[model samples]
Target chain A: MLATTIHGPRDIRVEEVPDPTIKRPTDAIVRVVAGCVCGSDLWPYRGENPIQAGATIGHECIGVVEEVGGDVQQFRPGDFVIVPFCHCDNTCAHCEAGVQSACDNLSMTTSGQGELARVGQADGSLVAVDGGAPDAALVPSLLALTDVMPTGWHAAVSAGVAKGGSVVVVGDGAVGLCGVLAASVMGAETIIAMSRHEDRQRLATDFGATHVVAERDRAGAKAVKEITGGVGADAVLECVGTDQSMGTAFAVARPGATVGFVGVPHGVELPVGKMFQKNVALRGGIAPVRRYLPELLELVLDGRIDPGRVFDLTLPLADAPEAYRAMDERRAIKVLLQP
Target chain B: MLATTIHGPRDIRVEEVPDPTIKRPTDAIVRVVAGCVCGSDLWPYRGENPIQAGATIGHECIGVVEEVGGDVQQFRPGDFVIVPFCHCDNTCAHCEAGVQSACDNLSMTTSGQGELARVGQADGSLVAVDGGAPDAALVPSLLALTDVMPTGWHAAVSAGVAKGGSVVVVGDGAVGLCGVLAASVMGAETIIAMSRHEDRQRLATDFGATHVVAERDRAGAKAVKEITGGVGADAVLECVGTDQSMGTAFAVARPGATVGFVGVPHGVELPVGKMFQKNVALRGGIAPVRRYLPELLELVLDGRIDPGRVFDLTLPLADAPEAYRAMDERRAIKVLLQP
Candidate 1:
């Protein structure tokens, strides 16, 4: 099977690898029908995140079950499914509490960015696609339900975005664009997207962003304040995990508002005193993708949201290197790979 | 007028001070009938929080309105009220959102711990006690409503303590004991109080703690886990703002749980990575005392909760120095001062 592997910074390659097999009673072997590059992948590609030698990358996929261990009861061979980023037994207290992302028996199986990957805790990790294999046109959107879309939804829900409320999105990546769409779906009245790039800004608008502020730093926060008449947004979605993005999110939120974040944090220190003074609540972390899959899948199936538009570029799995390069160079909002 | 003043570290004195008079149209001069030393007061008393020479001290007070400026409409002379720690206009967006503690025209009126304290934003800062001034026996209870009781309620509410949920109180101080009471009032089925002191433990039990874990640090969290059958508490109220208490609060909370904190944070840094991985949310800051005053006051008046029991010692205004010393030496749970 062909799999994506990284040897060092900017050294992604698609190479022949041994096919995966179900190694545990709770495991299932998946033939990935589709996979996509993630914003988080850029961390290691840019050398911002340390990488191990010959590590398989990527963590999002939609696939068909090829084989399942005897103990797997929820899925069977040829079953189309969305494999959430995190593998969990799904019966633990955490999983029961709708936070399977923090499942105690958690195993990360999506790191094997290959044509065939072994998924652990199959019963809990795999969400069978409704009505079997989706049409080719719906594949990208269905695949998105695996992570990005749910992540965006988590950001909105965590921020407590509600009907007639306002939200400010603090990144323009695919996740940020999805956040705009998610906030809209959640009934937010005003969705503000912060993007400096013209293309990303346009996509943000199409995704339901009512305003776009191209300025960075204090100026950007100032723009949000101005747009909201100096009251700031009701909720701020911090899709980027930089200190600057966190700062901007906090700066543009009105007193008593909340900032929900989903990007993996890096060097982020919450100014407790400032947060305390403003009574702003900072609430968000990893999105429990599995928790919202059912609702989000329904929305996607019903055509209520078109989050798949985030994938501006698509290529064969063999062009994995080009996909990474395009996203890293900002040439693609997100790249979809066909296996 | 007699007032409490801090001349230096560990140096408290009750001496003659100029009588407070209305300086703003929105101000009301309250003759403090009851005042109390707070856990936060120990910061400056022990020199942890620096104090200017001869700085007026004290923040918790229940008093009778002696005079009101022309613009004050909420109260007239002879009205008894609870003066929350913070003074705010109560009409700002933040106030309207039930976070009056973060009101735009916020004022720290508690600094002048004098008999005649002129309160700014009187209409918004004072919650008139139902009926007239109560008997002397109810003085301490009314004073508790000013800060400690509401602070505890904030911790429980911010942590989202729902009916039948479990909560862990991280400190055994008056605030922690009050948190135990607050959680019980909020309908928690399991309230775990973490305390090593016998008096506090007994008080915690009296305040409705279903369980008491006397251990500290990791062992403390382990005890909580044991109590919940390997799952942590559903809500953890952080009443001590130290790093150790913060760590314990986070450790004792299950994934998807929240830690509501009200202690003035000192040397506390939230480990974002750890919190992120666990899906634990940190949600509390300064309690908006004004927001919960009405409901809490009703609870007190209806005899549903007795938070004033936390004041184990009472002292006359002239003995203010003794009150500070008792709290600093841990010889008293709290000290009430009568002016």
Candidate 2:
């Protein structure tokens, strides 16, 4: 079996590892078909985040059930599935409240953790598609539904972007580009994408961004304000998870508008007083991807949306190091690794 | 007519001024039935806020219409009315959105401004009661409706406090105490009032606060978490508008809960990042007093609620300066000035 391993900062290698085997009743052994490097992945690949040696790094994957545990009833061998980033028990009060990311029995990825680990609640964590087996072309998009697509959907949906609302997306990574499509499919009258690079901006436009502003929060907020007759945008998706992006989201939203954020926040905080005075609603977190996967996949299957445009570089699993550097240097919006 | 004027910080005086006259078509001259010292008023009176010479010092008032201009058709020679701290035209888009304080035609009290100043959109700003005159027993309560009562209601309502929810209040001033009553009426099951004084705590308990925590934000947050199974309070009402009070409100509310703030913010800047991560909502501002005046008047008129409990001291209108001193020195929770 093959797997991607990180030895140190900026060092990734494809190595032979033991084949995955179901160890728990609630587990499923799947052969990774397509996995993508996330922007969040850069934090650890850059060694800014703590990582252990010889760890299997990818969390975003679309695979097939090679084998199912005794307790696994819904998923079966040979079924194509999308795996959410977080594993949850799915029966807790928090899960009932639709905050699956904050579920009581939640499992986050850790280095050295085996591939065939119990999904905690297998039926709830994996969503099987109706199609027999996803084609090579659909693999990237299906795998995207696991994290980025639903996360983008969550940003648009949580910010309450509906028909005829104006939406501004901050960040130009996979999630931000996907957000443009999400807002467009959600019926937003205007979609603004803030990006610097021409390639990402072009895809953002392809993804249904009505306007593109190269400026960051302050200048971006000004541009959006001017575009909206100085009232600011109706909904803003802060996908960068930085102080600047969050500030721009708050600034560009009109009084009584909302800003949805899905980026794993690093140093961002909310201005409680200003939000109160302006009646701005701030909502978003680690997305409950499973909650929105079914709808998102339907959109993908129906050809109403295409999120795979986010993948700029696809490579064999051996090129994980190049994939990490390309993403860190902004050479690629998203990279797909085939295993 | 006699009025309290602030010539300088700490130099408020009771002075005789010429009687007011109707100067505009929509203007009405009122003989003040009663006026009181607000905690916000203490800001300028104590020299913390700059005051121009001879500025009219009182904003919270109940008055009888001594005369009406030719265009004033609602009231004639004698009608008791509650005067909101904010004078709004009520015709602008902001006012139409129920934020009368942000109305385009809003007027602020200025030094040496005649009492016969126009009340724009008088129809919407003034709520007419059935009787030409109000009962003496309801005078204090009616005055409370003009600012503190409605302001407090705005806090709880904006905070999204509901029946059987837990609440924590951050101030022990008149508005804070009034918020306890408001939360109680809203059926908050657990109301925690943070007060250092025994008398104000007693009044808070009488006003419906079930628990009293004498700490500010950090400790208060811990106290609330200790009480609510480590989940924090369901809602927090910020009655003080300082950095500490704002931080406390954020700390006390659990994730996804709302914090209502009605205090006249003095030197408060909100922490935007922490709030966004915790998923707490920040709501409320200078309350739109006109929105709740009608309902509050009905409650007071029916004797179902009494807001006068906020006023623990009474003084003649001639002693307004002394009343201001008493409140500034923290000697009086609130002082009622009888004319």
Candidate 3:
């Protein structure tokens, strides 16, 4: 089997690897049909995070179950499924409480950008597509439900986006664009997207952003406030985990508003004093994509949303290095890889 | 008029000061019926906070309206009112959103310990007791609504305390004890009070704390976890603003739980990483007491709750210095001053 691996900064390669096998009775061998590069993947590619030499990478994918362990009851061979970025038993206290990201028995979905991947907790982690695999055109959208779309939905829910509420989405990455979509789906009356790049701003607009602010920092918050009639947004989605983005998210939130952050935090310090004084709340973290998979999959399959448009570039799995480079240099919003 | 003034650290004095008069059309002059020393008052008393020489200090009180300016509509002379620690116009965007603490035209109640105090935004800041002044025995409870009780209610509401949920309160001050009462009113099934002091623990048990954890830091969190069957509390109230208290607040919160904080923040930094990873949320600040005044006041009037029990000591107006000293020395949970 061919799998993606990283050796060091900017070093991505697709090489021959041993095929995955059912290691436990609750495990399944998934023949990945589609996998995508994630924004977090850049952390190691850019050396921002320590990398384990030649570690298998990628956590988002849609695939067909090639084989299943004896204990896996819900999924079987020939079933199409979405693999959540994180695996959970779905029965633990936290998982039962809808916080599957903090499940007691949690594991990351590594080796998804490969010909075959072993999925643990198969009965609880995998959400199979009803009636088998659908049209090829819907693959990317279905693949999105594995991580990004649900993450965006989590951000919107965490921010408490409600009908008739105004929302500000910080960051223009795929997740941020998805946040705009989530807010739209949640019936937010006003959606503000902060993006400096023209292409991302256009996508943001198409994804239901009523206003786009190309400014950064204070100017950007000022722009959002102006759009919200000088009172700031009713809810804020922080999709980029940087101090500047977090600052803007908090700054543009009206008193009693919440900032739902889905971005993996990096060098971010919360403004506790300002948050307290303004009665602003901070919520969110690793999204419980597994918890939201079933509902979101229905939305995607019903064509109510087209989150797959985020995949601006696609390539064969053998071109893993190029995929990493494209996302690393901002040439692609997100890259889909066919295995 | 006699008022409490602070000249420096440990310099609380009962001194003659000019009586308050209407300074704005929205102002009402309140004749103090009862003013209580707060936990926050000790900050300057202990020299932890910089003192402004000879400044009038108390901010919690129930009073009778002595006079009202032309624009004061809801409150009139002879009406008794609860003066919220923070005053707001009640019609501003933030106030309309139910976060009066962050009202656009916000002010503080600074002269409540005096014979007469001027309250700005009178129509918004003063919640007049219906049917005129009530029995004297209820004065202390009405005073509690001004700050402590509503603040505790805000913490519980912010933490999303729902029926049958479990709760943990991190501080043992009057506000924290009030938090125990708030959680009880909210129908939390298991209320854990973290307090080492026998007096406060007794009060906590009386206020609906089903369990008392006398440990500090890790041990306290451990005890809470044990009480909650190792799943941690569903909601946590961070009533003390110190970093250690905040740490314990976050430490004992279950994943997807919220920590509602109301204590004046002092050198507290949030554990953002832990919060993100565990999906724990942080909310609350200077409470929007005015928003919650009506409901909580009704509860007190109905004798369903007795938040005023937190006022364990009483002092005459001339004995203001002793009141401050008793509170500073932890000899009283809270002190009520009659002017």
For candidate 1, please provide the TM-score of chain A on its own.
Answer: 0.98
Q: Once model 3 is optimally superposed onto the true structure by TM-score, how far is the C-alpha of residue A34 displaced, in angstroms?
A: 0.5
Model 1 compared with the native: what TM-score?
A: 0.98
**Cα displacement (Å) at residue A106, model 2:** 2.8
Would candidate 2 be rated incorrect, acceptable, medium or high by CAPRI criteria?
acceptable
Model 1 complex DockQ against the native: 0.69
Those runs of model 1 whose alpha carbons end farther than 4 Å from true positions after fitting are: none
Cα lDDT tens digits, model 3, A159-215, are 999999999999999999999999999999999999988999999999999999999
TM-score of each: 0.98, 0.84, 0.99
Docking quality level of the chain pair in candidate 1:
medium
Candidate 2 predicts chain B with a TM-score of 0.94
Output the number of the lDDT-best candidate.
3
lDDT of 3 at B13: 88
Root-mean-square deviation of every model: 1.3, 4.1, 1.1
Give per-residue lDDT, candidate 3, residue B43: 91
Candidate 2, A76: how far from true, in Å?
A: 5.5
TM-score of decoy 2: 0.84
Candidate 1 C-alpha lDDT tens digits along B166-211: 9999998889999999999989999999999898889999999999
lDDT of 2 by residue, A1-339 (tens): 667778888877777766656666877666567787888888778787787887777778777777888888898988877778776667765566566776666764321112332244677688887776777788778878868888898889778898988899998899998889999998999998999999999999999998999987577778988887766787889898777778888888876677888887766656655776676767777777777877888888988888987998998777777888899999888998776
Using DockQ as the measure, which candidate wins? 3
